[model samples]
Target: AQTVTQSQPEMSVQEAETVTLSCTYDTSENNYYLFWYKQPPSRQMILVIRQEAYKQQNATENRFSVNFQKAAKSFSLKISDSQLGDTAMYFCAFMKHAGNNNDMRFGAGTRLTVKP
Candidate 1:
């Protein structure tokens, strides 16, 4: 079984600043994918970034980047140059890559507020 944990229940950052949301996971499976998703008040789960367990390089999408520490089972998301639109509920998720099982485990979620 795999589980994701987000220690911070809420976070706030000033516009144009940077914030890092922490996430750690416990998993017996080595082959998997980790993701960071953002859901605004609209409730749409948007993919911020994704990282493969086999890839040593971190995944980045625009101002969103991940610090994937495979040994520590840590996958943190760094939102650089935060904007007002970045205010949303962020969720860390994990899914196995081997099987057809599309099941994904998500964290409790961290509400991020980007202040002007």
Candidate 2:
């Protein structure tokens, strides 16, 4: 069974600063995908970034990026030039590339508060 762990239950970042959220996972499958999903106050889960296990380069999207350490099974998200709108509950998710029933496992999530 695969599981994602987000050690931080809550995080705060000042506007215009950078914040990194820690995430670690346990999995034996060699081929899989890791994702960072952001759920704002509206409760919409937005795909922040995704990393393929086989890819050496990390995934990035605009002000969002991920530090993917496949060997250690560590995938963390970094938010640059954070804004108040970035505040949300962020979840780390995992799914096998094989797409078995399109099943995906999500972490408990970390509540991020962006302060002005």
Q: lDDT (CA) for every model shown?
A: 0.95, 0.93
Clashing pairs in 2: none
Stretches of candidate 2 exceeding 4 Å from the true structure: none
> Candidate 1 at residue 40, lDDT?
100
Tell me the tens digit of each residue's lDDT in model 2 across 21-112: 99999988998889999999999899989988999999999999999999899999999999999999999999886655655899999999
Per-residue CA lDDT of model 1 for 1-116, tens digit only, reads 89999999999999999999999999988889999999999999999899989999999999999999999999999999999999999999999875666779999999999999
lDDT (C-alpha) at residue 2 in model 1: 91
- Residue 25, model 2: Cα distance from true site in angstroms: 0.5
Please tell me which predicted candidate would have the highest lDDT against the true structure: 1
User: What's the TM-score of every candidate structure?
Assistant: 0.97, 0.96
